[model samples]
Target: MTTAPHAETFHSDGTPDASGRRVGVLLSHGFTGSPASIVPWGRYLAEQGYAVAVPRLPGHGTTWQDMTTTRYDDYYAEIEREFDALRARTDVVVVGGLSMGGCLVLQLAERRADQVAGVVLVNPAVNSTNKQLLLLPVMKHLVKAFPGIGSDIKKEGVVESAYDKTPLKPLASMVAAWKQVRAGLGEVTAPVLLFRSAEDHVVDPSSARIILDGIASADVTERVLAESYHVATLDNDAPQIFAESAEFVARVTSQVAAS
Candidate 1:
């Protein structure tokens, strides 16, 4: 499938603060979704003087067929590469994401605790109560894809640019990565701000429960998006996410500087 123009990656050259220190924010989109899913959030941070990078995952922003050839490791490697690049240019880095992007950033926070100053997640999926996911190991061999989980937004006229089908093999890989990330949640020390939609259709609330209960970070906050669904970043509560995230970045970076 031809990639939509809006699905392209987004990057911003951040300006340094008065102290000559630069702050970078890396935003990751969910599985089968492109940078378009989180561009507004990234742009809001960039406008607030933070450098932002929203990269298209290796197999995303293209076609479901392309995503079939990729794995969770490929997605993680892409985020890792973007994180290193942002860290090289800035003094403080804040990472955040939606859905699977949230899982990837949590993994980064676990491994690079010293470099990651803060994290923001929207409807993060660490564990799921969905029984169908359990059969992925076997279903992947029999089925090439499943129904799409994209555009789970409550707001009218807003649609997410994502795949029409969920590729099975890559999804199995994602499930494996989710297990690994959940096991290592205790290693994350960075401050966290999480948003959960009260009525999500794709990811169950259990995913949010696991994240809130497992992460070792003492500085964690959770908010409910009452007016949205799974893709709250583009739904009715998007403004709340954008505003709160900008504040979260500022607060954490300021605290880091004072320390």
Candidate 2:
């Protein structure tokens, strides 16, 4: 009667059923994205004997309308719920995300404390006032007036969704959420492993340095994805991301075990 964890198509990205494994990594995807985006990474982890949960937020993986129907709090709340589930099923957690998802994971670390063993951020969104996104409200209203590039996310090797059309209201809500998350960096206590692409066209690269300085974690390490772009998850350097992230998780899990 029991099913394998992650067996469901819609992964909650929270905790897993505690049948055997004790370690878990919860993955949160970026804004305007879905569990499908992060599923590859989670599947890789799952093969390594780790329970991986990739949570799809309210609006994601559905339609632009769904995204508009969601709020920033709604998005963060899903992450919170999933992280708590992971906490219940595992002894330690290494929480991570890409872009906006990365910001949410950090918020979880700050808010949840040691319950989160470590943090991993891949091109995380830190600040909210960047020029391209300053006119988000307008973009939402007139997305068709100017259907922007889907994803210029150039990694050395991977190609992600390059959708031309965009829904505006969702982005506005995300911008508001990003502002809230940026204001909350001080609360993160878990150690961090940050990966930033040198040529990320979407998020500002400089923000990583600011995060490295601002977070409260006692230890922080960074990796530069020189061959990647904004959506590293689907970039050519994705393998590197998978490999490096795996090592990071192993290292942190070991640290907690020793202590």
Candidate 3:
């Protein structure tokens, strides 16, 4: 029932870029996870003088039981609100996420193509080949949850501070929303930078394949995180994620500003 420290929402208005343009980045955490997982990444970007917003999804950051009270729409609605707020203050915005957060930002790119300057995804999950997930609709009614998918970091001392249980109802909703997100992937025209861990335990390679194959963006880059796991943003390769994403943001935003 208690929220973890650093699980709260984080935002910054940021200083203007070299172009005197105020650019922004919005990051969403994954299902059953909170902003605590990605705040460091956001902070890294904010320090680069880019406005940043990291919103805690509705059902997360509290307890698994609390997550049962919400659905995927609740989470996406919060992302939409934060995206709109960032857009209000910045000339252009680049959206990114980890896991389900990645899927949520992809939805943003689909619906607001003109507004999203670029997309950065870390271990984004869109589809799963897991046979157990197929039983979610029936299993959710019979049971409350399964084991948690938290703290899949390859680093020994690092823990994700995420929920210990994966609420079935919310998980099912996320799966359903994936269909919707996949349907609109072709609408996502913004350049995409995706990072997949070579040794991930939470999300598998299928999700990445679906995303790369479905999106319409011609400018897509995929990098393999050789040393990290699912939570690469907080794993051993975090520095790589932060530095490269900063470069990705710079390249895309400048292109958008020029055009």
Candidate 4:
């Protein structure tokens, strides 16, 4: 695995939200996305008097060249380390992620149940095959050779760049990560707040259904972002994401009091 140089940094315009024993929230962006995707959500939560961190994964925010050298363990390890940091800063840490980042958070909640107070997943890619959609692992290999999807497939509430070039190797890595997380789904017992886009074409919608059906968390609540697509964090549904997530954090924080 290629080890990239680590430059640690934290900059938030809002004051600490964990004052007076409040909860902290950690936001993670999807694969191929930098903290930029979760910046809006982090800022919104921070402004509401909550400490938030949107960590930059190793090799990310640098270049596709750097990402090409990293492995799935490298990605998952960085998130686990960051989640620990967030936990140290506050009494309760509510974790959330977008897309593959969502899968990372779910994996964390399963194993570190005591540390994570709650979860919010936006357009999570839990299972590769959702919506009766067949994403042949073989297709990724094929796309590696011929990486053009022809035209930009337009969806509501967002504009997709349409990664015409599929790096089959990267596809294989992400799938591996998903498989590990999927196996650990039963372990993530924290109450989860799930969001799905009715129009998302990237990740399978069935991914959400599997979580809803099996997770031990009794307080799971799901909302459909009817107005948006896969990248709901950037689309019109962003406001709804902010509002609902803020509420979910508050709900979990109250649990601390009850206990």
**Candidate with maximal lDDT:** 3
Better of 1 and 4 by TM-score: 1
**lDDT leaderboard ranking:** 3, 1, 2, 4
**lDDT of each candidate versus the true structure:** 0.93, 0.73, 0.94, 0.73
Q: What is the C-alpha RMSD of each candidate to the true structure, in Å?
A: 1.0, 4.9, 0.9, 4.4
| lDDT of candidate 2 over 151-239, digit per residue (tens) | 54664444444334455666677666766666778888777889899887778866797688778888888988877778887776788
Q: Model 2 lDDT vs. the true structure? A: 0.73
Q: How accurate is candidate 1 locally (lDDT)?
A: 0.93
| Better lDDT candidate (1, 3) | 3
lDDT, candidate 1, 57-173, per-residue tens = 988988899899999999999999999999988999999999999999999999999989999999998888888889999999999999899999999999998899999999999
> Per-residue lDDT for 1-259 in model 4, tens only?
4322322333353344333675678888766556766777888888887878888876565555555566667767888988787777777888999887888888889889877889999988778654222454666545542342211223443433333343455656777667677777888788899999888767777789877876788789999888777778877788999998998898888787579
- How far residue 67's Cα lies from its native spot in candidate 2, in Å, is 1.5
Worst 10 residues of 4 by lDDT: 145-154
lDDT of 4 at 27: 81
C-alpha RMSD in Å of predicted model 2 compared with the true structure: 4.9
TM-score of each: 0.98, 0.84, 0.98, 0.83
